[model samples]
Target: MAHYERDLTGNVDDLVAHLDRAIPQGSISAKYEAGSDHRVGDARMLVRAYERYSALGGNRVSLCISVLAVGEEMSLSMVSAGGSEAVFFKVNTFGEEAFLERAIQALESYPG
Candidate 1:
């Protein structure tokens, strides 16, 4: 598995929409599996799950993105998993890491 986290300032809705567009555009096999947005008092949260074909692993891998915002501050977390093919211990993590690179590129390219 691979993980990434960041804290920044932006409109939650806009950030979510940006990621919604950016993540899936990285590769032809990338896709948005599901997503959710929720609000509580002055805070908001968004979670999105995506899948992409991992050529190295010969399988599909998952990427999960979670965002939380309150006022003008936002926190983002992303995790990539499911590419390992070991029967027990983990192996072949390159596919997972490559999948995560998509999210990193999208976040770095965010206009905010």
Candidate 2:
């Protein structure tokens, strides 16, 4: 099984390393708009990346972490041979945090 992991820590090197490790030989044609290097500025960018990647015939998974003055949030999603799934959790960031946590958990626990 291939493993892909990404953290929204704004760490470009870490993101690149994870992509390199996760993608199989010749599986990934390229890396488009990784969250590292500030290439991913918003949720729209992320969604677009995933859509494009999926079109390329590869599994795509993403974990996004967002920090705000009020609190923090985490989001997770998967797109692959099994299909596509996404969830959001919202917790300390008011109600948004709970959504983020739940989304991540659901996507992670999904049988697919």
Candidate 3:
């Protein structure tokens, strides 16, 4: 699993927008993990999981992206999975850097 922590300087709206845009293309599922029950940044904490496919046509892996708020800032956490089960027992490892680069970059560059 890969992990990253960033100090984000922005309001909830700006943070949400940045997170929303950084998500990779795939069918995603999200839910509140803490704080308020609302769907937006009001939740204070959110977890998203999505499927990733390999080019060689094998088992798909499930990766997770978690967002949480601390005081006046927010942070993103990403975890990678190795599809080592059944057909994916010997499959190639996924490159998590490619998946998270955009999101991390967005956070570092976001002005607000």
Candidate 4:
């Protein structure tokens, strides 16, 4: 799990658009949901991947990312399958900071 607080503001649509650019197209499938909670904007994403495991003959990957925004503050969390689960196995192969950096970049570049 990861957490971030930022002094930025934007609509959920704009935020989701920025996130869309951050995610890679190699994802086999992706789902996104955006809404507001107590005046705070929120977005959730689920992504499934099989491309990385095609060569290794390994299990696929399932990733979930959630973002919450209120005023000039934002919090983000990302988790991947890593334990005994239903559809995919979890693997903590990368640092959350990497994803956070990409999100920050996206937020900065979004004109809205």
Candidate 5:
């Protein structure tokens, strides 16, 4: 598994839209699987799950993203798992990292 987290300053809706577009850009098999959006008090929360076929590992990898926002401040968390190449053990993590990179790349230019 691979994980990433970041603290950002931006509108939750904007960031979510940006991710929704960029996360699935490179591969045809990449897709958003599920999501939840909630607002409690002043905070808005979004949780999303995505999956993609990993050729390097010959399996499907899953990526999950969570965002919590209060006004203009936001916190983002991402995790990637599965797609290990080993049959008996979780050895290869390249697929997870690679799939996670799509989100990283998406955030590169975000002014958050």
Candidate 6:
């Protein structure tokens, strides 16, 4: 698990830009649900919108994001792709919107 905490400042776009800057290529796989149930592009978009909303509030933010690689026979195989990678963002006390945005950005941008 990797952790990041900061006095939040910036919009979703800013966070996305930050993510683009922070994460390297070939790190993150496609975004999926918590249980790895679905492939929803709109879910990713919602996270982006939340990040933008949090940026306007200047809230204290903290996050724990992790990357995992799982094989085909795993229990959480719904989203797994026969040794695919997954990223998880866990937030605490931060602006919900901001935290979610950062999480999504981190998920999308992280280098596996």
Q: Give the winner by TM-score.
A: 1
Residues 1-112 of candidate 6 have per-residue lDDT tens digits of 2233332322334444444444322123223222222224422221211112223333322332322212211110001111112235343323443344445555445333
lDDT of 2 by residue, 10-94 (tens): 4333333343333322224323334432233432223313111334223343333322211122232332221233234311222
State the TM-score for model 4: 0.42
Looking at model 4, which ten-residue stretch has the lowest summed lDDT? 48-57
The order by descending TM-score is 1, 5, 3, 4, 6, 2
1-112 per-residue lDDT for model 4 (tens digits): 3334444455654665566655543333322333233432344332222112222223433345455655444555545432222345434434333433444565567676
lDDT of 1 by residue, 20-70 (tens): 899999989999999998999999899999999999899889999999999
Using lDDT as the yardstick, the better of models 1 and 4 is 1
Please give the lDDT score at residue 17 for candidate 6: 45
- Candidate 4: residue 70 lDDT (0-100): 52
Q: What is the lDDT of candidate 5?
A: 0.89
Number of backbone collisions per candidate: 0, 16, 0, 2, 0, 4
lDDT of 3 by residue, 28-85 (tens): 4222222222354444775665555444334455556666775576676766564444
Tell me how far the alpha carbon of residue 51 in candidate 1 is from the true structure, in angstroms, after superposition. Answer: 0.3
Q: What are the per-model C-alpha RMSD values against the true structure? A: 0.8, 13.1, 5.7, 6.8, 1.4, 16.7
User: How displaced is residue 48 in candidate 1, in Å?
Assistant: 0.5
Question: TM-score per candidate, in order?
Answer: 0.96, 0.22, 0.55, 0.42, 0.92, 0.25
Query: lDDT for every model?
Result: 0.91, 0.30, 0.52, 0.43, 0.89, 0.30
Candidate 4's error at 6, in angstroms? Answer: 7.4
Q: Name the candidate, 1 or 6, with the larger TM-score value.
A: 1
Model 6 / residue 9 / CA error / Å: 31
User: Candidate 5: where are CA atoms >4 Å away?
Assistant: none
Candidate 1: C-alpha RMSD to true structure equals: 0.8
lDDT by residue (tens digit), candidate 5, 1-112: 9999999898888888888888888578999899999988988889999999998888999999999999989899999999787778898888899988888898775664
- TM-score (C-alpha) between model 6 and the true structure: 0.25
- Which 10-residue window in model 5 sums to the lowest lDDT? 103-112
